[model samples]
Target: MTEALSSLAEAFKNVGVSRAYGTPVKVVGEELIPVALVSFGFGGGGNSEAEGADAAGLESVAGGGGGGFVLPLGVYCRNGSGHVAFRPNMIALIGTLVPLVCAVGFTARGILRTLRR
Candidate 1:
């Protein structure tokens, strides 16, 4: 599980450029699970301050977006009767919702700003 999480993080870091971020996996019972919360941020900027200055002759225009995900802990069992059962644990529900909500708010703010200008 650790290796898998490490690999995932490394992959994100490689492809995400400067804003790839991930959390370590957590273990519950016999299952290795994601940390329940993971986030990603993306932005674009000039290669140098001079280029930004030359383009805008003021401040460079940059934008960033972020989003997150949640994973819940669960349990599965099978009995001799061949019945299956599942259970969910609450941990990251709010964590996941908050980031999404914030992202939406940020998006709205950006749109409003653009409209105002």
Candidate 2:
């Protein structure tokens, strides 16, 4: 329907990379925007049966679902000197780093073993 399409267009207009950045807040002498990584997904399907649609004249059984996640990554802060800096979320940093460190460690171990052999 045109109404549905127009609403969808409006939703997309409001949803974008900017959503990952939060409104600026001031703490002490600095202004900070809490930043996060954002993601979303959607899926839909429909199956039509004549028996299900006889009276209504609508045939297709339609369904859709979606999900999203936002992970706080850091903040962009502007200090008194008018300089901006990124301050990372330490826990999130470590959470990402551990897996990457493990992968690199395993790769290095494999390479060393192959060289020795």
Candidate 3:
């Protein structure tokens, strides 16, 4: 278990800021540092015995999982005047916003129903 936990910790370290920033690319006399929103997680499978259930119970296999997402947020680019500015990835931003908007709309509908009661 210690080894597994240690490995997970190392995995998180590798997934940190290093993955969020990319190698700088120079284009047309401008330098751009690509940026991304990185996210990840790890989980250890649960034990059926902890809940005091039968050894052959349905919860015997609590499968654990690890996953990650890297969404390119945009880049830090140096303009002609040497000022660094952030230019967002509109497509990725819109992809994220669509779900957010839907969630807000659903939440608003629930709140409106509660208020009407």
Candidate 4:
């Protein structure tokens, strides 16, 4: 289990915010650098059992699993004025904000109820 966790930690060493930014591309004399939202998760577990008393035992069991995903947020591009700007994906922004908005609304509702009481 220690080795498994150690390897998982090592895997993340090279993954950072910079990984979310893609290399720049040039089109029509303009440079565009893509940016994205990145997230990752990892987990591990183990189990062991003894079959008998003294001098008798069974081998241990172990398992591990991990997964990750990324979402393209938008890109940084130079406008006609030659100034760099960020242009976001409306749908992605909405999707990211909806859950946050719902959480805030629920918290506010709970607070209002408590105040009234």
Per TM-score, the best of the predicted structures is 4
lDDT tens digits, residue span 1-117, model 1: 345455556766654412222343334423222222235544334433555587677654443343554355444444445465544445455665788999999999999999999
Q: What shift in Å separates residue 106 of candidate 3 from its native position after superposition?
A: 1.6
The TM-score of candidate 2 is: 0.69
Q: Can you write out model 4's per-residue Cα lDDT over 1-117, one digit (the tens) per residue?
A: 888898889879999878899998998877899899788888888766644423455467678888888898998998567899899988899999999999999999999999999
Candidate 3 vs candidate 4: the TM-score winner is: 4
TM-score of 4: 0.73
Backbone clashes in model 2: 0
Q: How many residue pairs clash in each candidate?
A: 0, 0, 0, 0
lDDT of 2 by residue, 1-117 (tens): 345555656776778778899999999999999999999866566668757596987966776666888889999999999999999999999998999999999999999999999
- RMSD per candidate (Å) reads 12.5, 4.3, 4.3, 3.4
Question: At residue 54, what lDDT does model 4 achieve?
Answer: 32
The CA lDDT of each predicted structure is 0.50, 0.85, 0.84, 0.86
TM-score list, all predictions = 0.30, 0.69, 0.71, 0.73
Off by over 4 Å in 3: 1-4, 45-64
Q: Which ten contiguous residues of candidate 2 have the minimum total lDDT?
A: 1-10
